[model samples]
Target chain A: MMSWLGETWAILSKEWRCELRSRYALSTVLLFAITTLIAVSISVGPAGATPEQRPLMPVLLWLILLFAATAGLPRTFVHEEETHTADPLRLAARPSCLFCGKTLYNLTLLLVLEAVVTPLFLVLLQVEVADLWSFAIALLVGGVGLAVGSTLIAAMVAQARARGPLFAVLAFPILLPLLKLVIDASFVAVAGEAQSPALGLAVLYDSMVTVASLMLFPVVWNP
Target chain B: MTIKQKTFRWLLFVWLAATIWAAFFYAPLSQGFAGKMGDAPQSSRIVFFHVPLAVASFFAFLVAAAWSGVYLWKRRSIDDHRAVAAIEVGMLYCVLATVTGAVWSKVQWGAYWNWDPRQSSIVLALLYYGAYLSLRGAVEDSEVRARLSAVYAVLGFVVAPFLFFILPRMASFSLHPTPGSAEMDREIGLVVVAAIAGFTALFCWIASLRRRVLDLNAEAG
Candidate 1:
């Protein structure tokens, strides 16, 4: 157990070092999110939207995050495959550990993104999150859900042709339910509607995806 | 085909044809299947075909997921063939259901697309298996494809319940009519039940035939 944690940590730190050196994924995702935020704020200027359309603001924020994640997160595995490092990494670490570490990296990356973008989204759009608790939970849990689904898909996508588009194609449908739940959660946050089971469902979505991915990642990551 | 197999095929053909005829001629077009909501009563005949196709498609995907689980456990190429065949048939049925529902929607709800919860749910389900097919297409090696696709199939099965059930129901109201509402005609109900059974059998027979063809290809190549 200790060895498993150590192995996972090693793989995670290896990912961090690689990211720190290149800033490839971080920069790509951040730039995508920032650029989309800019376009959204420019066209749909702060306080420009009517009250009828205001309820959709948080949903738009999530859409930006979803597209940004899909654009960049699959590189976690695709990069390893591209550089021919996957085989050695497979040999060195257990499949579950590799999965855990990669998912950890993705979760952190998404958190970093949300931290940067959410405040900007709110400020630029002048969107009032009436229920900050639900909004925050939705971001955190929905981000975790994205990380888990994206990592498994990244692993699968790495083995396939046209890795870039296939990652989003495969990941999007699986993430749809989570996206629905998150949208519901954020809708409440935007509309000041009464709380719903959206957060609980999002958690359920995360756990189911996480457990299934953990069980199956070994098989997917292997021959 | 064996004699019994031929006999069953003829029976299914007759049964389904009768179902279609009855759907239009025998089943009464009630006042409103959607009760007060005013979904076109004549359009409600779509339930006879649409419900069956939707149910069968959902069932076919589950069967594929089961076969995928079998392949993962046993690592048989035959199981993979079965999974792929089931998905292909499932996709066919899913598309049929979508078209039928869309046409019915246009007649009943004044749009080919209503963005109804049920419609989105079915579309999401279609994409789930669509991704499975694309995954199979992208991989060159048979064994690796089977293994990786099987993992995804199982993952999808786990998520299927929430996708099919909870998320769709989260909306306060869906424009799609509920099946067992009290105002629906009993005659319509009977035909729907019969059609559902008939279509499910048809789906299974077609999927098995496709599976046999796959098995033959495996042998030939």
Candidate 2:
């Protein structure tokens, strides 16, 4: 068990080191997020007084995150494949270890993203989180789900042609339930609702996708 | 086709014909909401067709996913073929269900698309399986395609219940009625049941034919 954990950490650090050197994934994802946030701010213009636009805040936030994720996450596997390092890595680490390391790396990237984007979104869109705790919990849980879902999908699509388009096409439907729950939870957070069923749903979605990814990843990774 | 299979196909055809007849001629039309259109008229009959096709589509996907799981375990080419064949038929039935539901909705709700949860969920399912087919096309190597798509099929199936069943129930507003919320009439229920059976049989027959065609192509190639 210790060895396995060590191996996973080794893979994670390797990814981090490579990413630091290239900065390809980090810059592209942040660039996408910032560009999308600016476009949304310009169009919506600092939370117009219209009540109709207020409800769209959560959806727009999630849309930006989703598009940004689509831009960046596939590189976790596609980069390995592109560099022809996947075979050596496959030989060195267990599939589960590789999955854990990759998922953790992706999760970290997403967390950093949410850290940056969420505040900017709130400031620019003028959206208030009535329940800050619930909103944070929603983002945390939703980010895990997004990372888990996208990592597994990225592994599956890494070797395929047209990786970019295929990743979004495959990832969107799988992520829909989680997105719905997160959007709903954010609405409740915005509304200052004491009880948010959407948070519970997000937790459920996170568990389901995480477990499914764990069970299915070995097959995808081996291929 | 073998003699037994040909007979089974004939039986399926007859059963489907009877189901359509019962739907239009025998099943009582559903009453509309109070102070609205008095009854659903002929448009309600589409449920017999639409619901069954939708159910069959769900079943086909389930079968495809099951076979996909089996392929991953055993690495049998036949299992992969069966999985793809089921998905192809499932996609056809899903599209038919969507079109029929849209037509019924247009007549009943005065709009072709309302983003109704049920309708939207079906569209999402279509996109999910459509991606599966596209993935298969995009992969160059047969073994890699089989393995990757099998994994995808299994993963897609796992998420499907949440997408199709749970999320819709959790949503605050849906134009579609909840199952068992309105008690369906016994006569109409029987027709619906029969229609479901007929569609299932039809699906099995089509899937088998598709599998055979795939086998022949594999042999020829």
Using DockQ as the measure, the top candidate is: 1
- lDDT of each prediction vs. the true structure? 0.89, 0.89
TM-score of chain B of each: 0.93, 0.96
lDDT of 1 at B128: 84
**lDDT score for residue A123 of model 2:** 88
Worst 10 residues of 1 chain A by lDDT: A45-54
TM-score of chain A of each: 0.97, 0.96
Question: Which residue pairs come into collision in candidate 2?
Answer: none
Tell me model 1's lDDT, rounded to 2 decimals. Answer: 0.89
Worst 10 residues of 1 chain B by lDDT: B31-40
lDDT of 2 at B133: 95
| For model 2 chain B, the run of ten residues with the poorest summed lDDT | B31-40
Model 1 TM: 0.95
